[model samples]
Target: MTTPHTVAPSERPHPWDRDAPHAHVDLDALRHNLALLRARTAPGVRLLAAVKADAYGHGLLPVARALAAAGAEAFGVATAAEALALRGAGVPGDVLAFGPVRAGIAELVAADVALTVAQPADLEAIAAAAAGARARVHVKVDTGMGRLGLAPAEARALIAAVDRSPLADLEGVWTHLASADEPDATEPDSATHRQVAAFAALLARLERDGLRPRWAHAANSAGTLLLPEVHHDLVRPGIALYGQPASAWLARRVPDLRPVMRVDAPVTFVKRVTAGTPISYGGTWCAPRDTVVATVRLGYADGYPRSLSSQAEAGHRGRRVPVVGRVCMDQLMLDLGPDGDAELGERVDLIGGGAPTAFELAADAGSFAYELLTRIGPRVVRRYPGT
Candidate 1:
C-alpha cells in the first residue's frame, strides 16, 4: 500500500538560475531497492529502515516517508533528536533511536521514541523518567561489537529491572555486526558468524528465562542480505535502502541494486585551451594538447572529494571526460577533449547518470561511499523524482 506518490514535494528553493550543482534523488529507485530487500528477507521479518546521518545524506524525512510507504514496519535513527524530528514531522510507526541519548529523557519518552538501555545505570534513569507515561526501551546486548550495549550477563537483569518499572516498555532488542561484509558469507569461522553465534546463545538464554521483547532484530543490510538465519523479527537496512551497496561484497550479491542519488551540474563555462594550459589551483595538471576545458560548478566544498584531483571523471555528451585539475572550493575543471560539443548551461552529470559513480569516485578518493553521500554540503540543492 505504501508508494512514493503518498509523499509531498519539498518547498526548498532550487538552483534553477544557473549551472549550480544539485543532487537528484531517484525515489523510484529507492522504492525498487526496498522491494528487492523485502522480497529476499525472510517472511515475517519486518524491516526497520535506518535513516540516521540525514538518511545517509539523501535527506531524512523524504527518505523516511518513502521507505515507510514502501512497507518498512519501523525506522531507526542514531539520536533522540532524530527520533523526535520524525515524530514532529508526523512519520507514523515506531521510531527507534539506536545511539546514546544526549537530550533529556522526558523529551524522548514524551515523544514516544525508543531508548536503548546499553548500561545498567541507563535503566535506573529511564525508569525514573517514565513516571507518568511508558518509555519504550530497547536493550542493547554487546554480543561482540565491543562499542555499546551491556554485557550479556548484565543484559537480562537490566531488562528485568526495566520491565518491572511501571513507566517503561522493552519493545525491541538488537545488536550491530562488525564483519558481516567481510570474506563473503560462507566462512563458518568468520567473526560475523562468531558474533551471530554469541547473539543466538544470548537470545536462547533470554528465552529460557522467559524474557523476550516484542521485536528481536540483529541484522544490518549486509547481514540481512546474506544470512537469513540472523534475520529474526526485524532487519534494519541503512545504506542499502539508499540504493547503494553497503560493501563491495554486498554489491556483488545484489547486482540489480541501483544508485538513487546522482550529482549533476550544468556547464558553467567551456573554453578552448591551448597546449600546456595549467588548470585550477596548483598547476598539477596541464593540457596535454589543445582541448576544450569545461568549468563545472562542483568541488570539495560541495561535498565532492578533493582527493580526486586530476583523476576524476564526469559525464558529458554521452561520453566520459577527465577532471583535469586540483578540485577547488566551489569549482573543478574537466578536460572535454577534442571534438567536444559541450555548451554552456548543458546539464552534466558529475557523479551519477552514467558518469563516475559515487562508489567509484569515493574509491578514487580513498574513502567510502557513505562519506561521499553524507558529506555533500547543504548548499547543493536536492531534486527528487530525478531520472
Candidate 2:
C-alpha cells in the first residue's frame, strides 16, 4: 500500500518567487571560482577575498559564507559595518576592513575584525578605542595609489608606533595597486611595476630595520593573475573572485573563470507594434519594421544602466534581441523581431548565462565590470541557488 502523502508547509515568497526581476547567484560557481583563484596562489600564500560592496552586489553574507566554506583565509571589506556583519553571522575567517574605520571602532575591535591604519590619527583613534584590548590592524602604505594610505616614508614610523601601542597588534602591511589592471601593467616601466617595486623596497627596509610585519601583501586581482612575484604572503582578489577579469589583458591570460551572477527579468508585457511605433521614453527608438516588443521588468534603478538603453541585447530562448529606445526607471523594451515567440511571464537574460557577460555589458555601457556589478540596486531581488 502506498504511504499517505504529507503536505509540506507553505513557505514565504523568496526573492525569486515574486513576479519581478531577480539576480540568480550560483553559489557553486562562486565556490568553483574561489577554488580556481586559490590554485593560482602559492601553497603558503593566503587569499583574502574582497567582499566589499556587498560582495560586488552578489549579497554579502551569502557570498562570504560560501567563500569561508570554500577555504578563504580572509575577507576584505570596505567598512567596519561590513566586517562586523560577517562576525555577527558567525562566518569563520579573518575579516579585514580595507578602509579606515570612522565609527564602530570599539565594536570592530571586540569583533576581532582587522582594521587598516593608514595614518597616525587612525592609529591613535584605534588605540584609544581599543580600551586595552588587542585590536588587529594592517598598515596601509600609499606605495603609489595616492588614496587612503600613509606615505611610504611615513609608513615605517607608523609601524613602529603600532608596535609600541600596547593595545594594537600589527598583523600585516598592504598597498593598493593603482594600475594593476591596465594592459601594460606588467611592463617594467608601468605604474603597476613601479608600485610593486616601491612596496618591495619598503618591505626590504622594514626587514633590515627589524620592523617587518607578520604579513605583507600588494596584489589585487590583476596582480594576482599576472604578477606572481607580488603574491608575497597574501593576495586580495576582488573582481576576479566574482568571475570577472580585472582587465581585458587578464581575461586573455585566465580564460576559465566562470561568472557567478545571472540577472534576469520576466517579460511582464508583450505587444505587436507597427514599424513606426516608439518603444520607450523620448521616442528615441522607432521600430524599423513590424515587430514584437517585449517589456522586461528591469531598468536603471535596478542597476541596468540607462546608457545601455539602445546598445544592449537580451537573451531569450537562445535568440539575441535588441533593446529598443531609452531604458526607463523601472522597465525596458526589447525588440523581439517580427516573428518573435517571447511570451509574457517568460524570463529574459539581461546579464550572464546566455546573455552578454557582465564585462561585455559594462563595455557596451562605457563602464567596467566593477561598477556594473556593484551598482546592482536593492530593488532587484538576489536569490542564491544551492546555498
Candidate 3:
C-alpha cells in the first residue's frame, strides 16, 4: 500500500501557469526616463510623450498613466481611436492625434482631442464635424519629410482657411523631422538642418503675418535629444521615453537612460543531446559536442524576430548562452553546455533585465529597437512588478 501525496497550495500552478512568457515593464524606469528627457528640454518647452501603437507595445493605458503622473504635459497618438482611448482611461492633459484622421472626426471633436490638419481636405472635414462645437486643430507642414503634411508653400493657404472657419481654433503648427536621428544631423547641408531652417523660416513668416498658431513644434526623440534649437514650443519623445535610445548617436549621447521593459520566458524542456545531433528545423545548427539544450516558451509569433534565429543570446543562470538552431513559431532552443543545469520552468531573460539589451538584440536581428519593441505580440503577458 502507498500513501497518496497532495500538492501544496504554494506549489500549485499560478493563474498564468508555469510556461507563460512575460514582458516585465518597469514603471520606475519609465518615470526616470521621462524626467531625464524633461531635464534636456528648456523651461516652458512642453514634453509631448508619444503613446501611439499601444504605447509601443508596452501596454498603452498603463504607460500613459505612468507618464501622466510623471509630469508629461501632453500625449501624442497616431489615431483618433488611441486619443479617445486615453481620454476614456482618464489620462489628463492634451491628447493630439497627429496621424491622419479620415473617420471619427465628430467623436474626436466632441471629445476635445486635437486633430492634425495635414491638408485642405482634413481641414474641411474637421470644420464640418465641429458643427456648433469648437475644434482644436494643428496644421502640419512638410518641412523635409515628404510623407504627410502640406508643402511649406501651401501651408499659408491652409492656415488662412482654418482662420476663416468659425468652429476651428488654430492651436498649433508642427512638422516631422526626416533625418534627425542620422549622424550628419549637425551638418549645414544635412536634411535635418535644412528642415529645421525651413520650419523656422515658416514659423517666422507666420508670425510676421499674424497667422502663427499658439504652438510651433518640430522635434522627435532624436531631435529632442540632439537639437535644442529645434525644440520650438514642444518636444515629442517616443522611444526615449520608453527607455530605449532612438539611434546609436542618441545612445552614446544619452547613456544614462535605462530600458523599461525586459522580456522573460520559462524553459519548458531540458535534454542532453549527443554530438552532431541537429536541433530545431532545417538542421541549421548541430551540436559540435554532447551538450544540454533548453527550450524556451517564446518565439517569432510572440514578437521575437525570426531573423534572430541562431543569432541572438539569452541569459540563463547568470550565464550568457547562444540561441541555437532556427527559432520556431512557438519555441527556441538555447545551447547550455554539457555541464549546464537549467531545469524545467526556469526563467530565461530574452531581452534586458541585465542580459543583452533591446538594442543589442535588435542589432543581431539586423533591425532597430522601435520595430522590436512595437512588434511584441499581444499574447505575451505584460507584468508591472513595481507600479
Candidate 4:
C-alpha cells in the first residue's frame, strides 16, 4: 500500500496568481514613445524597433508585440535565437539579426529573419546557407564604430560579391555611428559627418558598381535624434522605443519622451533596530540611531545592482528611503528613518518612482540605463498594464 503524499499549496501556482518584485510596463508610455519617434523622424523614414536584450529586459515578447502594434515597421535583435523568439512570439514584422550569422542559417531561414552581412565572410556564409530560401540581407558598413562591417572601399567589393550570390538578397545598406550621442565625442569636429559621408560614398560606389539596395539606413537612436540627416530609408530606435531618451542630445531635443518601464516591489518586513547595530552582510551598515528599516523583497539577483548598496533609494509615502547595507543576493535592506509611515506589505517604488529614476541608479552604478534594464534578472515578474 503506497501512502499518498500531500503537496503544499505554497508550492503550486494559483489560477490567478502573481509573484512579488515585478517590473510594471506602461503600455501608454510605449505607445507615446512610438508616436514621438514617428513624429520626429523624417517622412517615409522607417522606424525599426530594437528589441534586443529582451527588449532591454522588459519582456521581449510582450514589448515587441506592443511596439509592432504601435506602428513599428521592423524589429532588430542581436542574435538569430532572439529573432526566432520574436517570430515565435507572433511578431509579424521584419526581424534583422545584428549578431553573428555563421552556422545558424536554418533558424533564420525557418523564421524568415534577415541577416546583417557585416564582413565579406558573413555575406559568403549567408549566401551559402540561404540556398533557395530567399534570404533578405542587409550590408553593414563599418564607418566609424570599428566593430563590424566592411570598410568603405571593401563595401563595393562586398556588394559585388553579394550581387553574385543567388542565395542572399541585398535589401538594405547601413552603417553605425560611433559618437553621435556626444556631439563633441568625435574628433576632427566632424567625425559624425565623416561617417555619414563615408556611408554615402560607399553607397555611391556600390551604385557605380551596378548594385542598388532597396533601402539604406544608418541611424541608431542617438543618430536619429542628433542628426536627422542620417535618417535614410530606416532608423533603428532601441532605447527610445521604451521611453528612455536615446541620448543626452535627445533629452535636450525631446524633453517630453516618457520611459515605459517602472520597477516596483513590496515591503516584506519592517522593523526597528537600535543605534550602532550593523545591518546586512559584512556588517557594512550600522543604525545611526534608532532607525526603522524596511526589508524589500528585491536584490542584486533581480538586476538591482549591488553597487547601489549605499547609494540607491526608493519612494515610500512621499519620502525617500535609502538602501542600506550590502545588497544581498536575494534581499535588500532600506532605512526608513526614525519616523516613517510605511508598513509591512506596502508598495515601494524602486526604479520609476517620482523620486529616483533608473537613470539615477545607472549613474550611481557607473553604467547606463540600457545596461540596467537589460541586466534585470528573470525572477522579477514583468507586468504590462497596457497590454
Candidate 5:
C-alpha cells in the first residue's frame, strides 16, 4: 500500500483562480532589497523606508510589514492619512509625515506620526493642535529642492518658534535632495553637493543656537547609496525598496537589487491573419506577411500604456513579440510573427522578472519606472507570494 499521505490546508489552491491579469509582488524579494540597503548604509545611519504612493504601487500594508521585519527604523509617508493607515494596520514603527500640513495636523499628533514642519504656519498649526501633547516633528529645510520645504532663513525662524512651544518635540531636521540621482552629483559644487552643504550649514546654525534634533537626514534612495555625506543619521529609500533602481549609481553600486513586482496576463485569443490585414484599431499596423497575433487580457485601463502599443514588446514563452497598433482600453494585440506559437491560456509576461522590465517599458513609453509601477490600475488584483 502507498504510504499514508496528508495534504495540509495551506497546500490547497485558490478555488476561483483562473487565467487573469494581475501584478505579483514577491515578499521575499522586498525583504531582500531592504536587507541590502541596511548593509550598505553608513554606520549609525538608520533606514526610513518610504512607503508613500502605496509603497510605490507594491501594496502598502504588505510592503510595510515586510520592511518592519527587515529592520526598517521608521516609515516615511507624504500625508497624515497614509501614516494613519500604517498605524491602523498595527505597523510598529516610527512614521514620519514628510508632506506639507494641508489638514489633519492634530490627527497626526494623535496617531503618534511625526510631522515635517516646513514653515512657520505649519509649526503654529502643529503647536496649537499638539497642545499638551508631545508632537514629534522633523523640520524640513528647503535646502535646494524648491518643493515643499521651508527656506533656510524660514527654517531658522521655525526652529526658534518650536523651541518656544512646549507641545513640540524637535525629533529631526531633514531636507530633500533634488539632483542626487543625476550624473556628477557628488562632484564639487554639484547640485546634490550644494543641497547637502546647505542642509549641513542649517544644522550647524541650529546647534549653535542650542537647538538639536536627534535625527538629521537628507539622503533619498540615490543619496543613500551614492553620497555618504548626506546620510546624516537616517536615509529614506523609496523605489529601491521595491527593487527598481533609483539611480544609475545605485544600479552600479548594488548589483543585486531584485525587482519585486511583475505584471502578468493570460493570453485570451490567438488568430491567424493574412498579409495586409490591419491589427487592432486605427489600422495603423498592417501585416507584411501572414502572421499569428496573440491578444492578452490587459489594456491601457489596466496600467498598460497606450504609448507602448507600437514601441514596446511583451514576453511570451521566453520570446519577445512586438505590440501592434493601438492598445485598446480592454485588450491589445501582439504581433507574434509568422511562426509565433502562443497557446491560449498561456501566461504572458507584460512587465516584470525575466521579461521586458518596467524600466524598458518606461524608456519605450518615454516615461520612468516610478510611473509604470504607480500607474498599475486598481482593477487588476495584486498577489503577494512566498511570504
Candidate 6:
C-alpha cells in the first residue's frame, strides 16, 4: 500500500521580504469569495477550490486554509508537492492532484489525497501504491480539452481496471471545458455544450457498466457559471472563487464575486518632464505636454505584463493615471499628466480598487486573467489582511 506520510515541512523563504514592488492579498476578500462559491453550489454538491499555482500566486497553504474555513469541501492543485503542502498545512478536505505525481504517489495516496488518472500505467502505479489503504482516485476523461485524460472508450477500460484494483476506489470522473470561457469567440455555436455533452456521454457509458462514482464533475469556474446544467456532483471553482470572473458569463451570473488580490506599489520617483522628453528605454513614449512621470517599481518581472505598458492605468490617491513608455524588467513609468499632484513615496494601485481589474490587465496585455494572476512573480510581496 502507498505510504501515508511522505511530505516534509515547507521550506519556502518568506515571499514578502522584497524591496522593489509588492502585491497584497486580502484574506477577507478570500473569505468572501469562498462564501460566494459555497452559495453557488446546490445542497449536496461539494465545492473543490482549485488552489494550484500557489493558490494562483497568492500562497497555497494559507489560501487553502482560508477556503476550507470558509466552507470549501476540497482543494485542487496542479502538482503533488502542492497537495503535500496543503496536507502539511492541515487543510481538511479532499486535495486532488491534477498533474503527474512522480515519486510522491505513495505519500499522496497514504495521505488520502485524490489523484487524477489519465494513463493505464498511472492507474497501475497508483493501485500498487495504494495497495489496500483505500485511496480515492478520480478518472480524468479527455472529453474536449485535449490536454489530459483518456478517450471515451479507453477511459471505460481504464475505469474497469481501476475498479478491479483493490488499491483504489473510483471516486469521480471529470472532464475539462476549453471553450467555456469564451463560447462566442469565433464560431456560430458554443463548444461548451458540445464539451458538456461529451462528458455526459462518458459518464453515461460509465454508469451503463454499473460504475457509479461518488462524484461526477466537469465544471471549471466558467463551466460553473456559463453552464450550470453541468454542475454535476461536485463543482471545481478556481478563478471565480478567487473573485476574478473567468468570463462574461461569470460576471453576469455571479454578480457577488469579489476580487481578492490588490497589487500596489510605491511611486519611487516623480519628475516633471517637458513635452519632447522621451520616457524610459527607446523613448517609446513622448509627453503630449509637460507632465509628471511617476516611476513605479513594478514591472514585467513582477507579473505586470510588459505589453501593458501603453494600455495599463494606476490609481494615485484615487486619480487614474495612464502607464507610459515600455515596462522594463524591474521598473515602469506612469504618466500623471500635465497637471499632477502625485509625489514620491505615494501609493499607486496596480491591481486593486479604483484601479484596473485583473480583467482590464488581461485585456491590456492581450492574455487571460488566469495567466495574469498565476504568473505574478514571487518577488511581489503578498499581504493577507483582515483575517
- Candidate 6: give its CA RMSD in angstroms: 4.1
Question: Candidate 4 — which residues are off by over 4 angstroms?
Answer: 1-19, 185-188
Per-residue lDDT tens digits for candidate 3, residues 1-387, read 100111233443358755678888999999998988888899999999998888887878778888888899899999777888888777888999988697888888888899898999998787777778888999999988998988888998898788788989999999999889898997889999999999999998998999999898999988988899999999999999888988888788889898999999999999999999999999999998999999999999988988988898898888799899999998999999999978788899998974699888997889999999988876677777764
The best-first sequence of candidates by lDDT reads: 2, 3, 5, 1, 6, 4
By TM-score, the candidates rank as: 2, 3, 1, 5, 4, 6
| Per-residue lDDT value at 167 in model 5 | 84
Per-residue lDDT over 1-387 for candidate 4, one digit per residue giving the tens place of the 0 to 100 score: 100111133433343224377788887888888887788787888889888888888877777778888789899999776887778666778999887588679668767888888877887677677667767888888898999887878787786777677787788888888877774633446788889888878777777767979889888877776677788889997887777765555577678778888887878888888999899999999999998888888899888999998788888887788999999887888898888656677778888854477766788888888988888876776776744
State model 4's lDDT.
0.78
> Which runs of model 6 end up more than 4 angstroms from their true locations?
1-20, 128-134, 184-189
Worst 10 residues of 2 by lDDT: 1-10
- Write down the TM-score of every candidate: 0.94, 0.95, 0.95, 0.92, 0.93, 0.90
Per-residue CA lDDT of candidate 1, range 2-50, in tens? Answer: 1211223443443462557878888899999899889878788899998
The TM-score of predicted model 4 comes to 0.92
Clashing pairs in 5: none
Positional deviation of residue 154's Cα in model 2 after best superposition, in angstroms = 1.4
Lowest lDDT 10-residue stretch of candidate 6: 1-10
- For all candidates, the clash counts are 1, 0, 0, 0, 0, 2
- For model 4, give the 10-residue run with minimal summed lDDT: 1-10
lDDT of 6 by residue, 83-125 (tens): 8877877789998888756667888888888988888888877
| Residue range with the least summed lDDT across 10 consecutive positions in model 1 | 1-10
What clash pairs does model 6 have?
A: 2-129, 4-110
Q: What's the CA error at residue 266 for candidate 3, in Å?
A: 0.4
Give the poorly placed runs of model 5, Cα more than 4 Å off: 1-19, 248-250
